[model samples]
Target: MTLSVLVTRATFADIAQRLHDHFDVDDNPDDALWDPDELKRRLQGKQGVMSHGSDRIDAALLDACPTLKAVCNVGVGYNNVDVEACTARGVLVTNTPDVLTETTADFGFALMMATARRIGESERFVRQGDWTKTGIFDMFAGSDVHGATLGILGMGRIGRAIARRGSLGFGMRVIYHNRSRLTAEAEAESGARYVDKSTLLREADHLVLVLPYSASSHHAIGAEELKRMKPTATLTNIARGGIVDDAALASALRAGTIAAAGLDVFEGEPRVHPALLGLSNVVLTPHIGSASIQTRRAMASLTVDNLIAALGAGPQAGQPPTPVNPEVLAARLR
Candidate 1:
């Protein structure tokens, strides 16, 4: 009777099967992303909400949800959820972190290889019946992933995992740029050398962005940065959107400033920039970086756990595995 939950991405049928007995559940299985006003209307009586990457939980939304106790994001990145605002408003915020690290890292590597090797373009060509024994050298011959320089924009857990795959598994020379340098032991383990952003852009055979999005990170890779990259280099982004300037990236792709690009996320996502969509050199995918069936299910389950705990359903019910704004755990719960 004390717990109320609102789930945005997953359906009622899904959670009802699991938590119906413990809490009041309001679910939107249809996955309709409610606009600001509609979301405000929905949050009128809700104490907890489960959200996806697509949902925006910022200052405006926090101003409306007076009863909101917690927001459990189903994705690792909580950039969509403003931690400062939530902490101020006493709303507990948590995300799926370690559970999706390896899965997302694996995906970043996969997308990078796809971009460097022109995999998607080759597939489209073959599917269009363009294949023959001759295999025209210019048809789809692309860059090699092995023995290449792999550069990572952010060297967090997922980034380190990608570095291991590239450096240890593929014989790549890994380089990364982060806000702070990692310990010597970490560098030795991953075999990644820390370099400045410009050096990373110039030297890497392929670059992947895994950085978290924030005010300072918005448009981090714009014309100036993209122009520094090797013309033969490929680029991949599995990070949060807006980190790379979409318009700038599209121009680079169209102009062949970079060999090619693979993207699983975008700026202002779900509403991709039309220019980026029209380019053949760029492989666009619906944001599926953490979308493996198993990982997605785990994310869903973890989100549910956070919501139940947050609304005081049980022990660890109010204590999430990953809390972005831990201070909210002590705020007055009306």
Candidate 2:
């Protein structure tokens, strides 16, 4: 019997075709965002699903889809999926990690630079015809990026990539705070010094958030944290939404708590806070951290590979490369 699979969102043509060739595939080519009930209805009888980061997979949904054996997420962060719930149900969970690390790191660095140097504000000023009335020195004077202190909240693969870019390419001093310290060799490669969270906040000229999102991390940068930051420092978030308090951030920008901010994600995404929309010091972009064409394709391919292997249908059958809960698979074998 052929296993059934569902693609929850539109993807690269080749990826959809590949899944079609291997399974009884049901794809949402229209790329509609399904609510919980609608998603549960669509998932009926499906043995596997290729999921986007926006799709929420939880115990209730898993209960609704008894046939689901695997969930392959196209993004590195699996915050959308309830791993413990999936594991209890013996449903394999996988995410694409390394494929988009460098691409995302590139965007993070770019957003930080844009925020620091007021690139987005200056562009808007030019387009609004305000530039014609102002002289060069008096118009849009912004902060410098070179030789600044670069603080990273997470020192994972992408964080290390950002640190290397700041330290080697831009001559910036790199500091980071993570749950644990990296190896001495890894530290030497990125040229980052591990510091306490408070120090990372106080000393950084430009702070970048690349940490994973979780219960403890939600509102990690709240109003109090904002007050701890230097008045001239710029905050850039290329990490998951809900990691920072958007309302607090807006207030911070208004009060000049920090010089500026660049955000690619939000607390309730696709529905940015009205307050942030009104601020000139804050630069906002819809979540597109790993959005480069080449990297997105790579991520799609990895998700497909994971789904195939998890369902025991493709090359490397029974061994999905990046399982979020490998113990579930081990328990199944036992």
Candidate 3:
């Protein structure tokens, strides 16, 4: 009997064809966003699912999908899929990690550069014909990226990549704080120095957030942290939503507590805080950090591969490439 698969977003023609040959693949490639109830309703009887960031596979969703054997997430972050709930229910969880690491790091740098230099705001000023009235001393004078101090919140693979680009490529000083410090070799390689969170905020001219989202990490940068930052410094978050307190950041931006900010992910996401939208000091993207077409395809393909292997199919057949909750395999094997 063939395994059944449900995909949250339709990726490519070849992808659907490939899965069709192996399983009864129902591709929701139409790209319509489904509400929680609609998602739960469509997930019934599915053995595997190729999900992206939008779907939230929480305890309730896991309980509703008894037949679900595995969940493959396209993006590196699997916080949307509750690993604890999936493991408890004996459902495997996986994410596409290495393929998009470099691409995401690239975007993180881009957001940081844009935020510090006021790229978007300046472009809009030119587009609106405001440049004709202004001299070289125009309002949106931005900061420099080269020789700036870089503070990274998380020092995982993506964070390491960012540190490399900052320290080596841009000649910036790198400082980071994580749950555990990196090896001496890694520290030397990225030229990253470990520092307390407050010190990093105080010193970094450009601070970038690439940490994962969790209850404890929520609002890691709030009013107090923002207050600690230099008035001329810029902040950027390419990490998940809820890492920075939105209201506090908004207040800081309005009050010029920090120079500027770039945000790819926001608290409550898709629906941003109204105050943030009104601020010219901030640049925002719709969580498209890993959105290159080539990278996105790679992510989707890897996610499918993980799901196939975890569910005892595909070329690797029982060999999962990435495992967010490897403990689930123990219960499934029984």
Q: Which predicted model would earn the best lDDT?
A: 2
**Root mean square deviation (Cα) for candidate 2:** 0.9
Question: lDDT of each structure?
Answer: 0.85, 0.93, 0.89
Each candidate structure's count of clashing pairs: 3, 0, 1
TM-score to true structure, per model: 0.95, 0.98, 0.97
Q: Weakest 10 consecutive residues, lDDT, candidate 1?
A: 10-19
Which has the better TM-score: candidate 1, or candidate 3? 3
lDDT of 3 by residue, 266-293 (tens): 8888899999999888999999999998
lDDT of 3: 0.89
Q: Write the per-residue lDDT of candidate 2 for residues 107-184, one digit (tens) a residue.
A: 999999999888999899889987665456757677878899999999999999999999999999999999999999
Better of 2 and 3 by lDDT: 2
**Backbone clash tally (model 1):** 3
Candidate achieving the largest TM-score: 2
RMSD of each: 1.9, 0.9, 1.3
